[model samples]
Target: MAFSAFSMTGYASHTFELPCREGLVSATIHVKVLNGRFFEPTFRLPHALAHLEPALVKMLREALVRGTVYCTIHIGTLFALTSRPMVSSVAIAGYIEALNEIKKHLPDSPGDLISAANLVGLPHVVEFVEDPVGHEINERILADFSTVVEMLQAERVREGAVLADDIGTRLDRLETAVEQIAERSREVFAAKRQRILENLQQLVAQAGCTEDANEVQLQHAFAQIEKLDVHEELVRLRTHIASARSILGLDSIEKGKRLDFTTQEMFRETNTIGAKCGDAELGGLVISAKVELEKIREQVQNLV
Candidate 1:
């Protein structure tokens, strides 16, 4: 029930002994995860434990949000260490009878060919006796597996904290750059407005207008200048940055997706600001903000 950022990539392995009524059973578990958009889990277990896959997958889904997860469980040397070896009398007898039939066809065949040692070497002549406490062993395995998954979760959380810290630093830079851009944008807008006024005055003088320009003409000129203003875009960029910061502060499992979307919006606003502002200094600031946003986007992709 822990709520915190978790990275989509992590690895954890554990080797321990599971005590059963039969004896001590050694088990090894490996959990690896890679960045993915969905919960995709792959399990590699002994055929005898194939039925445990669904339960294991349920455990994983409860603990993880999104990743390509790989789970490998080895139960003590292919289930041999947990079970005892037994000689199958029926199989040995069948092998001996078959060999005798072959011997009747070839009277000169060597008797050693059908010896006990040779028959024991044949397939199916020797079998492993399954553990008497099979259900208990499976339960123990599930318990151990849960522990390993918790270990994996801890590793992922640690990595996520690191990523979040890095991203927060980058966000600070982006926010600062955006503030600078906003400040510079004001200056650029003033300069643009002044140039527009100068041009309008020149046009008025060339036309030999004696009286001041009418209100409708002045309003039209101001409106044209406002069209090139990036104030709204800069405001949205700031809002997006704040949203991203807030998401980073939350204890939500799906913050990665939210941050990603916020970054995209920030990019859109940055592009709009760049397109609307023609000042060289403002363009440079927009570019710097874009670089920071790109870095944040990269880190956000690794979060869960």
Candidate 2:
């Protein structure tokens, strides 16, 4: 399998059987990984092997970077008793008394209703303490476990490859959009300056100010012009696009979180550009860039 960044979602199953002194102990492990804000693991295991869950979870956590993992382990034994079931005497007595009282109301109830069969039927009345796996058997199972994990990681890598391609294509489009918006740079500055000059002229005209103060009004307008300029915003937008591409090109496993933060910065810059937009074409380009960034964000959810 190609090793690179991968999605946090995948599935894999493996069955292993070993001949032990007592019997043949077989285990079928099914692992399912789903996207989550953080890493968490839940395991469903047969009681005979439940005590080994902590070790199993630790192995998976070390192998996987992030995900909400659900792992199921079903162990079967042939020709030997792996565990001895125990009956809860207190629970059985309570269940029998409860059942007897209920039977009194139902005259048609059978005489065998409160027998041992009925007592065992009640939940938690019978229990078996999961036995710890033997060291040799545990080692064998864990060794095979690495193989299954490799299968899971392979699937994640394949998924990441596809997602990276899609995200990279969108980044290219964003770069082109940024260039076009920069090319239309003069229109935006001109519009902002015109608005500032008109506002100053209106203020002077309304107050019936003398012509000598018109120079002060012009200076004020220039200051506002400098403040509203979008060169910085455009430059940052382009830089964010470049950064995003650099991250995508890397084969590192940490791409997901980095890309997530970079896209947020890109979105911030796009919003600022949109606010300063005076031309319909620039506004449309900004909207398009947002759409592409949105798609990129969705794809990023799967990356590792």
Candidate 3:
């Protein structure tokens, strides 16, 4: 099966059991990925599983693509039940010597060093004895790591769903902006034609020529102005926008690179419209559309 697209928000927790010299030891692992960057994985293990670091890293590398990942491994018996008291023989001897020196100066009291030895010798210290589970511990850690990876991937898919919805909203806004640009393009052409006509009439009056004499010249001027029309550019821009929106709706993960390329095409078309139209108001509108497209492009970079 294909791997799910990488996402920045995800978390997984799991436990696995492996055979040990004393039966089986359970290893609990937790993995979390946030914001699509690999976070450091922290491993907590009983002394028995410390040797399994290499295997755990290998398993994690296989499962995660992007995001900060955290993995914690816990193993062995939870806590020692019967405590073993540890008394310091050396401490007792030192106390005896001090008591002898103090007795030389004063009558002995119950608080003397000699009396302290009895209490010191009975100092309760618990030593935790760990039975190394050897390779079995490593196996358990690897197994738990596998489960955590799978869980994290599922979380990534859920987060990706939300990202897809946000992208859809931005695309809708961009499409509306593109349509507005197309409409304004038509007005630009009409305005340009009217201005040219007025200029031609003013020139005829200055030259003391009749309207009939300049009729052919006026037709040629109109043809030249028509050649500069941005209607074709506007049509192409809208078509590109539609294609990009369709690409966004795809369930595939390969849409990022394609959407990035489309953003560039959209910018090119908007630039062409702004330059060819030569209307200040249309230019400002094109600029606004380009700004929105850039923002959309920035958000698309995070899409997987």
Candidate 4:
């Protein structure tokens, strides 16, 4: 059978590498899904890269329909660390040229030495730009982000399949419970009719001077017994069961809301059946059926 249901919970993780500067940086993305009515995405990225949240959220909103998604991206250098700082050739050349022109007018000093180490502490001369091409790196990683989304969707589909199977089984059990209630309702109806007639006859014998039972008294008694008629309720209950089964076997992604609504209707019918039942055993069966419906509802809540 096709599984139309989908779960609100899922998990997936992926790691990717993108080139930055003269080396490569490794990054990992983790995705998690939780219950929600809409596509709510929240991300935890590096402070410098937090601006990418809007773009990532937009992509997720387009990919997912319903769920609170938590995606975290962690990036770090793949190579070993070094104490030496990288120097900017452009900045160093400008600083040396400007300093040499001023040195010609200065007093002749033997200690006017400008070493390479001195340039390391100068402004804009030394730099350690880990990811020089930030925009390009971001674009590349975001392109691979589709893989993470696919993994998360696959997990949700697996969960949805399991949920559909469980709900289907519960629906079957509910159908059986309703069937038992229908049978008991019939038995209860016959017993109620016989007992009410017997009581009416007894009343007629006690109050009337005539030997024949009072016709007006029998009519009143029959009117009271009519309240015990639960045929319509039983028929409606079976119809609701069939509808629930059909919804479960569907292949639609929007089936969650519809399935939930159908179960609520079934619950209402079960309550009506209980109220109309005068027999303790029949009332108990109706309650059992209600319990089964409740079980189905709980499982359906997780569906998409």
261-291 in candidate 1: lDDT tens per residue? Answer: 9999999999989989898998999999999
Off by over 4 Å in 1: 1-4, 19-25, 81-114, 122-124, 127-133, 208-220
Rank by lDDT, descending? 1, 2, 4, 3
Better of 3 and 4 by TM-score: 4
Q: In model 4, which residue pairs have backbone atoms overlapping below 3 Å?
A: none
Give all TM-scores, in the order shown: 0.85, 0.75, 0.58, 0.77
Give the candidate number with the greatest lDDT. 1
Error of 3 at 13 (Å): 3.4
As for lDDT, the candidate ahead, 1 or 3, is 1
Q: Write one digit per residue (lDDT tens) for candidate 2, span 1-304.
A: 1225688899999998865656677778899999987779998876656667888878888778789999987767632435557788888878878878998999897887666676677798998754455777667767877777888999888888888888888888888888887877667778768878889988998988777788877787888787667799988988888888888778677688999999999999999888877678888988988999999999888887
lDDT of candidates 1 onward, in order:
0.84, 0.81, 0.66, 0.78
What does candidate 4 score on TM?
0.77
Look at candidate 2 and tell me the lDDT of residue 280: 86
What lDDT is obtained when candidate 4 is compared to the true structure? 0.78
Q: Each prediction's Cα RMSD?
A: 3.8, 8.3, 7.0, 5.4
